[model samples]
Target: MPKLKTRKAAKKRYKTIGGKRFIRRKAFKGHLLEKKSPKQKKNLAKPVIVSKQDTKAIRIMLVC
Candidate 1:
């Protein structure tokens, strides 16, 4: 049988920690400090867990 290839797209977008999946928040691109509010900017610096409904699909994509 051929080796199962990992999904490159998923590998780039998602990260696995302690068997849980996390994805970085979108927006705040370039992280310019001249506009976005402190709270919004600080919040975007964190990683958020992928929802349970989406976990299955993400795992498939990640081959994890």
Candidate 2:
């Protein structure tokens, strides 16, 4: 049987730590910053874990 290949895009954007997948947060470094609150800006800097429902699909894509 052929080896399963990992998704290149998923590999670049997602990271796995202790078998958990973390995705980079959006809208923090981009435009429209003035409309957002200070706490929102701070929170956006942190990475978000992939939801449990989606974790299985991401794991397959990540091949981790």
Per-candidate TM equals 0.71, 0.70
Clashing pairs in 1: none
User: Which tens-of-lDDT digit does each residue in 1-64 have in candidate 2?
Assistant: 9877999987887888776755655555577889989898888877787788888888888777
Candidate lDDT values, in order:
0.76, 0.78
**Residues 1-64, candidate 1, lDDT per residue (tens digit)?**
8766889988887888778756645655565776888887778777787788888888887767
